[model samples]
Target: MEDSGMRIGEVAERTGLSVRTLRHYDEVGVVSPSGYTPGGFRLYSGDDIERIMLIRRMKPLEFTLEEMRGFLDAVDHPDTPGARKTIALIRAEAATRLEKLRRRVGYAEEFLRLVEDL
Candidate 1:
């Protein structure tokens, strides 16, 4: 797991994700902490934080939890044939989404400029 000793609160603060959101991600099995204190506090690793960040990035892409899980699994097992296929599809979809977001942002900037001129 290469787990870090960082607690859940630290992880939430560092990742800009709420504590409840981190807990929910744990509950949903999207990203579970790699360790726990004897007092029952959740502890996260660096890898766990990276995984959470990946999930956060995917949120703007409107990926469902299942899709996030699949993507994570694919990342974890890139050598698998199915994982490779999933990665290919997700990569293409992400590029398309990025292009769309760029276009939308351009429109938004244009609107803001017009509004500012008034």
Candidate 2:
């Protein structure tokens, strides 16, 4: 809607996120408007877009909404400590998902074999 400050649609287009998802992020306190438009529309800034992009990519990494909030919080609040805590959180969940996927893939493979026999 506005080039000076990208509106929600432009942000969605640029970030490959749906407007609905952006609103959900707002409600979830994941990301919010830097300010409003002359017509009272939400206007996002470059910083907001960057954060949303990071969140977008992190989703498939299996980071929960709350964990994402934490990551954002950590980003906001820098730390000199080792990455053990962050690694533990992401890795444990990813491993869990990996195991679940292995089971699902195994089932699909068996199903394919049965289909071939039929």
Candidate 3:
């Protein structure tokens, strides 16, 4: 079934994805609209909405644009196994980032304590 062909604003609101992000996605060949309005506004279908949501969730996990491109490209395969590999990679990367953040937080706390001693 075809969707109502949502405008860019609607897509941004619905997916919690900024319009700029959507445009960037389009520019990077990540998630593109199925059609366009007369004014060249991107029009998104239901599938595009799902893809946008997936990209939104993945971004916060600290997935770089290059990593995202690789994962998105893997989806074009005839099989669905790439999802598992993608998830595994995200988990590992997120864990590493979390540890780095924890170290930064500890350093910040120490700095605060030292400042209070003055």
| Top-scoring candidate (lDDT) | 1
Candidate 1 per-residue lDDT, tens place, 1-118, comes to 3344788889989989999999999999999999887777898988899999999999888889999999999999899879999998999999998899899999999999999999
Query: Which candidate, 2 or 3, would have the higher lDDT against the true structure?
Result: 2
Q: What is the C-alpha lDDT of each candidate?
A: 0.91, 0.82, 0.81
Per-residue C-alpha lDDT of model 3 across residues 35-98, encoded as one tens digit per residue? 9877777889988898888878776566788787767766656267677687567668878877
10 residues in a row with least lDDT, candidate 2: 78-87
The TM-score ranking, best first, is 1, 2, 3
For model 1, the superposed segments whose C-alpha errors exceed 4 Å read 1-4
Question: TM-scores for all candidates?
Answer: 0.92, 0.68, 0.66
Best model number under TM-score: 1
- Judged by lDDT against the true structure, how good is candidate 1? 0.91
Per-candidate total of colliding backbone pairs? 1, 0, 0
**Residue pairs with clashing backbones, model 3:** none
Q: How close is candidate 1 to the true structure, as a TM-score?
A: 0.92
Q: Report per-prediction Cα RMSD to one decimal.
A: 2.0, 3.8, 4.0
Would you list the rank order by lDDT, best first? Answer: 1, 2, 3
Runs in model 2 with CA error above 4 Å? 1-3, 80-84, 91-118
